[model samples]
Target chain A: MPELPDPTHETYYSAAVNEALDEELARDPAVVLLGEDIGVYGGAFGVTRGLFQKYGPERLWETPISENSVVGMAVGAATLGLRPVVEIMFMDFIALTLDQILNSAGKLHYMYNGQVTVPMVLRTPGGAKGGYGPSHSQMLTNLLVGIPGIKVVAPATPAAAKALLKSAIRDPNPVVFIENKRLYPRRGPVSGPDFVQPLECAEIAAPGSDLTLIAYSAMVPLALEVKKGFAAEGGADIEVVDLVSLQPLDTDTVFESVRRTGRVLIVEEACRTGGVGAEVAARIAAECLDVLEAPVLRVAAADTPIPSSMDLEKIVLPGIPDIVRGVHELMAW
Target chain B: MEPKPIDLLLDCFRKMLLIRRFEETLSDLFERGALGGTSHFCIGQEACAVGVISAAADTDYIVSNHRGHGHLLARGLDPVRVFGELMGRTIGYCGGRGGSQHMCAMDHSFLGTNGITGGGIPVATGAAFALKYRKESRLVLAFFGDGAANQGTFHESLNIASLWKLPVLYVCENNRYGMSVPVSASTSCLPIAKRAAAYSMRGVTADGMDLLAVRRVAAECIAHVRSGAGPVLLELETYRFCGHSKNDPRVYRSREEEARWAERDCIVLLGKRLREEFGISPDRLESIRTEVDAEVEQAVAEAQAAPSGDDRCALGGVYA
Candidate 1:
């Protein structure tokens, strides 16, 4: 296993996004932002607080209620040499702007024979919390993942979120930077102002060899909780892998972990059908068929709309117990 | 900023004629099964593309739509490369990846055209924002069809452009139909220009078939927007002489309506105006036609002879 890198400071998940954006804005003149209520309202999740006052309206744009155009505007700005970060208020609303994101921003760089690059970041908060109901609380990362010419990043911790988002802003392609809504208040150590994560690598949050736990975004912390429980029980050494880059799968880390453990349990907050977990499981099955001691398993949200009630939500969403059960089942196999 | 000279008008005429001939040649090729897919042609709407683009500075930006060959040609994209792209050749502008609707000439400030209706409007507005933010002495012109005016993006884009005073000229080429739906049927308002008042911006309508009218109006609008007065909406009333695509059999409209629009053809209108107003001789116009025909023929020949785009590299360039 690769040695873990050291971090520098501690901050909340939302603060990580805010600090990264502030630092990027200070470092480059071309970086700008646009979204609904992001200026005075400081974003729907309060992730862009104080940026409006610091940079003013020129760089920080408070747009009208037009999701498609907001993303479209970002694509246009990116093509014309401006790096724009667009925030959709909710992940569900991203459906309105998929045409711009998929058809225009994602394809412009390639369709035009590399004549231009869409160096833009579409930042949105997904995952279920606060009883927001189906429309607002959807983990739709796979929608962006399936599209070519776009990078999809779903960081698991404050440090990972901050570093990966900065890298996403600096990347030469369009990036869908999805933040998990449930992780906004989760406090963790983040690297200092200069830290930037690689856009194509995954992080091994916990080192183990007996079994592997794979997850990303909000599910990573849940997987960690499962790892802690397994450790307390004096069971197998459960290694938890944080899949930070979702689209360009970090197969090196995944394959190595699966080969070492010979047992795998993938977890995701999104629906089970056609989720990232399914893809990761398929990759492991195809690449490490002989190495696997058991069939690859996935613990994802049930194939149903996210319920409004917390009781029903718990049943629908994958909880820490669900990950533990899956890990135990895989080990027994 | 001065009144454009006769040479500029002649240049516009040449480009408009080139686009007309280019589309005609494509029709002939498609008829013979040389080309694979259906293409949207701007047959009678040449003046809108020529007049609007001619008024724009070389540094200014222009976004086009599906029916965009005239716009691309008028923006000075090489006819040979344009033909190569339509023919899916390696020598094309986009290496044959973008057939017609998605090709872009970034060097010429011509943003790619969109197959999705009203998709490029906000992008143009964003480019306008960049231009103004960077303090560059340039603006963007986003061209969409009247059919696109119904899209929420069109209204939303205009609202933002006006609010922020972005340097964008939103030109709507109202050729009267969105596939089979006529303008009167699809549009809530007769002229798309009237809706601009809701955004608190100036809107104007002009005869899109008349080169002089389109040029005069577009020049004023371009200057106004370029000077940072904010965005302006210009709805050009025009018509398409050809069917929407290769599949149409002209069952949607009467022969009398088609004949009426053909009589007011922009290319014929400009040719007559050149002889009557500009004191150009019939022989000179005839010579210009002959020269443009030869140039287009040569471009078609070169494009047809060019190597087909490699399928091996088809998966490449999905990311930079």
Candidate 2:
């Protein structure tokens, strides 16, 4: 086993991803990396850096940017019993490869009547705030999660990113690993011997009863910040639920918390129209409507496209202010 | 071209004939309104699909485009299930989730074909990468038509395949038309094979009408990758015998042009070559044809008679 790094050490999500590759390669020879620039170039986001040299071109594959092909290849490989992780350059690019993801990889097992399994993970950079504009920025968590066969994991913190990625690779089921570029640098405590979530549970960032703030990926960090502010200003314990997974939602956890707090607020960086927030809100409303002390609320990016300017980008993407207001409004309601 | 053994040649002939009859059967059912939805016939493009698939191991995977029945049947997919799927039966490869355009079969190494052009290219890379990762020597043969070669995924997948030297063989069946539009209208390059130069891979064109030529070229491409030389692009100049699908009247192609290509029917060409050039007896050729016809009929009957899977299975394969 590679020596563990010190607890005080922290790094970017890119670094975490690199570390995951290193660890998994060391752990199992079957885990492979395939995508554009994943080998010699180290991937578009540098997630597969240094891996090509260590694992060689055979293990660390540099593939053509055929998202559909990349995913389809992984599905084929997984059926033959290899654990493959594919990096789909961007979440928005998924639309180009929807058939591969939705039709092939997503439904292989059921389509084959349990004769096969696709043990693969599609690692993709998603959500807005990057200057890439309409072509690149996309919140695909909702799209992937809506599919039945796959689980969509959006890791908000660096620790969660590494742990969730490892779990996704090892899982027998196909998982769409949606990594938020915005939260790549955020740090938090993560225990290991390695980890895998139970697939349908929410991780409680902080416990509280005044209001429940439910969020995932980049929005989780902003929710935590809002929770801290609320604790200091109003002395209220605003529980924060990090929905590490958008699909196979941790509805039980969020509903239980909301039922206790009588107030709830959902946050997302995706556009308000048909964003992941709608699905989360609908779940809460359907399951715990009577138990809520107030109506569930949502704070998300506006319907317009994300601006190129960093300042405007930050303003449009949900932030602590919007989250605080949403929480406060729910608390008062 | 390397001389192929008698058994392999016979298998190739069977596969091509099977595809011809299978599509012919579907054409009849579709025109008769039995099989709804779109059906892109590979009637003329049989050799390219069979040639590529023949060189790959059963476990080695395949990724295909929408007009993929030829590729699917070439890879030895059960005709009945495929027909059942087109007819919206649970017996279909996709369990009715994917109709005519979205057929999938993992057991036969026939990964599902997609509706989008060039959509399965990336997934082919993923499958090959997975195979390499597991130390499985499995390769991926991805089949796309000339129309798909122009999609963004074609550039992305080819570039990646060349850069990484992934074990992939890209077979572009340049049927000279994308629906009603000719290749000249949709593509700027003189030959689709030339596009491989942009990605740093050797590209070559072959006679898609001659089963021997397609087999020879496909084997070479597959051998190049299996030998660790990396991916190669193959452009097979062919034409679909039928309309683009059940609905396409193919107004873009002149009857004269169609006749010119039809003069080189891949299945018929191979049978003649076998009897004339290889010294196979006429009785042997007729026997093979009878066998192919009976096989297609049996598969169609079995698939039609098989019980549609339980409706509760609607959400069955989602998990595994």
Best by DockQ: 1
- Model 1 residue B179 distance off true place after TM-score fit, in angstroms: 0.6
lDDT per residue, candidate 1, B9-36, as tens digits? 8888898899999999999999999998
Task: Give the per-residue lDDT of model 2 (tens digit) for A215-298.
Answer: 888887788788778777866678888888787887778878888887888888777777577988888888888888888788
Angstrom error of the Cα, residue B145, model 2: value is 1.1
Residue B21, candidate 1: alpha-carbon lDDT: 97
Model 1 ranges off by over 4 Å: A1-6, B1-4
TM-score of chain B of each: 0.97, 0.94
Q: Candidate 2, which segments miss by more than 4 Å at Cα?
A: A1-19, A34-80, A86-116, A124-144, A180-182, A233-237, B1-11, B51-60, B88-91, B131-138, B278-284
In terms of lDDT, the poorest run of 10 residues in model 1 chain A is A1-10
A79: Cα error in model 2, Å? 4.5
Clashing pairs in 1: none
Could you report the DockQ of all the candidates, in the order they appear? Answer: 0.88, 0.41
Clashes of each: 0, 22
